[model samples]
Target chain A: MSTPIYNRVALIGLGLIAGSMAWAMKRGGVAGEIVGYARSEETRDTVRKLGFCDRVEDSAAAACEGADLVVLAVPVGAMGGVAQEIAPVLADGCTVTDVGSVKRDVIDHVAPHLPDNVHFVPAHPLAGTEHSGPNAGFAELFDNKWTIIVPVPGADRDAVARLTSFWQALGANTDEMDPEHHDLVLAVTSHTPHLIAYTMVGVADDLGRVTDSEVIKYSAAGFRDFTRIAASDPTMWRDVFLTNKDATLEILGRFTEELFALQRAIRTGDGDHLFDYFTRTRAIRRGIIEAGQDTDAPDFGRAQKK
Target chain B: MSTPIYNRVALIGLGLIAGSMAWAMKRGGVAGEIVGYARSEETRDTVRKLGFCDRVEDSAAAACEGADLVVLAVPVGAMGGVAQEIAPVLADGCTVTDVGSVKRDVIDHVAPHLPDNVHFVPAHPLAGTEHSGPNAGFAELFDNKWTIIVPVPGADRDAVARLTSFWQALGANTDEMDPEHHDLVLAVTSHTPHLIAYTMVGVADDLGRVTDSEVIKYSAAGFRDFTRIAASDPTMWRDVFLTNKDATLEILGRFTEELFALQRAIRTGDGDHLFDYFTRTRAIRRGIIEAGQDTDAPDFGRAQKK
Candidate 1:
């Protein structure tokens, strides 16, 4: 492993992304020591038992003490509170970053609370699974995944480079993007799609004509993927929708317009319109496979589950 | 391998489902001889080269000659024409079934044309992948999948029993349902979800702010699964929506109402409403996993893709 990037790294939340980050750092030996904190004592105990970090601290402030790097891995709604709590304890020259999906709101909430000496670079790892909590993490979660870093204006260049290398060491390819664009990109990529999935699953449940047992039994027919996505943590998604409101609403507007047009085509027996739309969407899937973001394997490699 | 379920089995369309059926039949020795036909000579040539069938026939009638079981694996739109073409050649005591997603349409279109001597039992195998064509087939595609059989009123019981055994021999569990309910269940479980996925992918493409490259590169954030579902066969999905128009539109309407409510909840900062909706959807996913229709593996077992 490469030399340690930071003397001490503090992770302020013990959830999926944070736990995975700890595991990835330990596997790559990227930090001299890792300290962790969570709002809940139960989560801290679980993390200690799992040995995800070098030390478990009672509070976020305690975890940040003497650490050269502090990562805010809490939900989007809790970022500001955690930032305010840990701001006083951060060491000089420490780099502060976050793994929140909405960057503009996170930067707005986190930037003012951090001291001038501490470098604030907000980052979002473009990777996750349906599972959450401390035990749901593995070292390979970030391998070959893209972690986008949104650096604020006039931020320290050396600190940004150091954080970039830190993420690189954890098996992710890093890119720099501005906060507003990052939020909009994530709105299109993650936020709206998740909401749509959740909405479809809700509709299926609300329909009394189709029994819940029937939906579950025959879920392989396209609905199963939506269910997988809809199964993501409710609290986290609630925060995402609330924090990224404007961007998510804009994307949802476009999505609703497109959906209405397709619905009209189906009603009018316009096969060509439906066929062309589906055909065009196939190219995007091909592009994703070519970019190595996903696999070309059929069924999303479902056979591997067995 | 078990005993042959039929002396001769004919597959009318040499696409993914039909080709996979041929492979499964060969692996299980469910059919003594498999005859395959497609509207296109290219597909027939590919099927012959892949050896998915024991014999490649020039026409649907030729394929059905002397066959005790004929499977119409064509798109829902093309089922009637193929049924009419092969009606004269279907042998006495032969069983004719289909693997269409929309059962009511398939039954309405094909049942009238079949000869009285033959038994017509409409079946739908609630399984598929985004990929299609003859080359996309595999012997294990049907393993542990559910195949629902919809038998018309006064349909021959013996024919239904034999077809159930055929699907079971191919490693699938079987159930019987009425055609109307089957169409409604599939609309909830498959049709509306697919249309939503297609529309979401289309919206992502239409957005100028998020470039296609960015969308493709960052797709794993829930958009990847939407792309996969949107990449399904254009013709097949088009036919499905057109054939199951009433049920799909009904579900789409319900979906829109639910989506609008959630959108309002987000606008009003109603976290409890959003949280409750998400929480309710999670239970359906859990039920899917418990019912053995989907794996609880995070990311749909995507790590195995690498």
Candidate 2:
């Protein structure tokens, strides 16, 4: 194992991302001592039993004490409160970062509370499963995934580089993006897609004519993928939509406009239009496969039910 | 192996479903001989090389001659033509079925063309991957998957029973539904979902602000699943939308209405509404897993990229 990059690393919330980060850090030896804190006592107990963290602190402040790196791993809505809670105990010159899905709102909520002595860098690791909670994490979650680091303007260059190296050592490829751009990119790639999925699943569930069993039974046709996406942590997704409102709404608007056009084409029996639009989207799937963002395996490599 | 369900099986249009049925038939000894035909010479040649079929015929009629079971495994729009072409050659008392996505449309297009001597049972195996073509088929594709059998009014009981047994031997659970209900259920579960995915992927591709590389590199977050759904066969999807116009459009209307409500929630900062909606959708996913329609495995058990 490589030498520890941070003498002490504190994770303020014990959810999927943080738990995975702790396991990854332990696997990589990227942190000398990993301290974890969760708002729920049950979560803390679960983490302690899991043994991925070196220590489970009772409070966020206690977890942050003398830590060289502090990670805010709470919901985007809770980032500011966690930041305020842990700020006073963070060691001077320690780098503070967040794992929120939306970056701009996180910076807005988190940056003001952090002390001037600390380096605040916001990062989002664009990787997760439909599962959540403390037990949902694995060391390999972030392997070969992209972790976009959104550094505040005029931030310490050394701190940024160190955080990048830290993520790299934890098995992620790191890139720097401005917070606004990061939010917009994630709006297109993550937030809006998730909202659309949730909407579709909700629509299916609300339909009185189509029984719930029918929707669930026939889901493998296409709806199961939407169900998987919609099943992601509700609180996390709520916070995501609340915080990333502007970008998510903007992308949703575009999505609806395009959807309406396709809906019209279907109504009008415009076979050529529907065919061309569908044919163009296949190129994008090909690009995703070629970029190694997803496996080319049929059905996302899902095991056949037998 | 069990007794053969049919003496000879003719598969019209040797694509994914037909090729898979050929393999599954071979695996279970469901048919004495499997004869395949495709409109394209390339597909027939590929199926011959794949060795999934006992014989590859140049024409649909030749393939249907003397066959006790004939499957119209073409696009929804093409089903009528194939049925008409094979009607004259189909043996007396032969049972004919289809693997089309839309049931009512296939029935309207194909039923009138079939001779009274043969049974026209429309069956749709609610199983497939984004991949298509002859090479995409596997024997396990239908294992433990549901196949909805839509029998025409006055369909011969013996023929229906034999066809259901044939599907069961090919590794599918069979259920019977009327054409109209099957169309409506599939519109909610599959047709509208595919259209929405295609529209969303098209919208992402159309956005100039979000570079293609950006959308692709970060797709693992959620957009990749949309890409997979959108990447499905263009011709098949186009025909599906055109033929199942009313039901798909009805579902699309409901989808857009639900989407607008959620969009309003996001814009109005209605976190509780968003949270409740998201939470409700999670139960359907749980039902799907419990029903054995999908795996509880994280991320659908996708293999981690190293």
Candidate 3:
């Protein structure tokens, strides 16, 4: 913990990312006073009970009033509406940023509503767990994770620098990327992978060859990984697919093409192709471990619980 | 450590499963003298340096001489040839088993070559890291894991009991399933899932929108999990797909059907369908955790490396 980066920080939509940001900000002394609001009363009650913020607000507009930094941590589909509600109340010179997974969609939806006095910088933090809601927040959720900052053209440099420093203080490594590139990169890295996992898990469920009980019981083989990825927050993912349609479908089309080729190889007993393909992918996993993004311990270093 | 189950145990291939079995058996006191062999001199040297086995033999036959148990831990494609080599030398009444992912193929390929005096019991342990070769083995690999024992009809009861006890001592819970059912179950849980993960990782590598460096750098989201599965032994995986073609293709067909449906829903903006499918998958994950096959830790309990 150190000197505060912002005097007051208000978080709109107290879910996993927002709640986690609150805990991480407090842990790093990045904000003096924190206030949070969620659309659902149940979520609000949960946030209040958890005490993630110094104060809880009932509305988004109330949360943003007089705050130096206001984070729009809502679902992508809801960002425009939330931005509309907060636009009238945003303090002058307040820096507004969002934590949505999709960047261009959020910028398009949110930029029109924000007042000129407030600096709107967009960010997408590549961090989270399958868990969600208020209880899912942790002080270390953003620790050592990547946060990509996508600033609109002609944006204030000082605001961008301050937000970058704020994210760094909250324990994330920051980098700059254009909104279009960010969407394309994330579609390949996160969005499409998640959809594939969800689809595979659903396939296992529908298959009669392996009963659901057996799939669940013997998941440690490989299916368990897909299940964990597939178990992410439902509404949030739905919104991500709905918002990042072009990039996602483009990646999916490529994915299906690659999948059909591999399927053909399997059917044809082409061991050389399969072996070569499998061997190449292993190098990328090694790169992830070498880059310090992941641990090399077998089974992701997860302790085998008895 | 307790009394040895067998005076001499020979492991035919010094790969991940064989090396782990050797270390685990020694750790749990199931084998008195463990002898191992691999065709690759490099692997043999690695195993010798590691001292996983009491003696390192140059050939499968040399390793199997006078052993009470012989484990064929080679890739599924090579099981029959290895079985033929050792069949002429296997001790009378010795139990010859394998650790291949597919059970029916192993039974069909290896059973005829085995001596009539030897008992053939095919087994597939439902555990492994996405690593291979001698150095990948650890004594704790089988702890809290499931090992499915696929005993052919008319298998000697005494040999089956001894093998069960040996695996139990190696820290695994054991169960028996018919060879066909085991193939079907594993095709769903392990083989098909691995293929899908491999296909997805390959797709990411081939995509022009996302650079390989970016894919590896921001892999923590969900792509990392797929990479881990995709990084598994190429030779071993190729054999699994080739030997278990029928079951794998059956389940894969089902997987494609489900994936296409989800992809259609995404194109048409069916948020409700997406949410419901995602929610249903979450329960399967919960069931896996409850069944003790996997831990409920966020990110599969992998500690965030600093």
The candidate, 1 or 3, that scores higher on TM-score is 1
Q: Tell me which of candidates 1 and 2 scores higher on DockQ.
A: 1
| Position A166, candidate 1: lDDT | 93
Best by lDDT: 1
lDDT for each residue of candidate 1 in A52-119, tens digit (9 for 90 to 100): 89899998899999999999998999999999988888899899999998998889899999889889
lDDT of 3 by residue, B1-306 (tens): 588999999999998899999989888788989999999999999999999999999988999999999999989999999998888899998999999998888899999998788899889889999988899988888887889999999988889999998898898889899988998888888898899889888988887767899998888788888998999999999999888888888888887788788888889989898889888888888898898877777765553444
Poorly placed runs, candidate 2 (over 4 Å):
A303-306, B303-306
Could you tell me the TM-score of candidate 2? 0.99
- The per-candidate TM-score of the B chain, in the order shown, comes to 0.98, 0.98, 0.97
Docking class of 3: medium
DockQ of each: 0.87, 0.83, 0.78
Worst 10-residue lDDT window, candidate 1 chain B: B297-306
Candidates 2 and 3: which is better by lDDT? 2
lDDT (C-alpha) at residue A151 in model 2: 90
The TM-score between candidate 3 and the true structure equals 0.98
Considering lDDT, where higher is better, how would the candidates rank from best to worst? 1, 2, 3
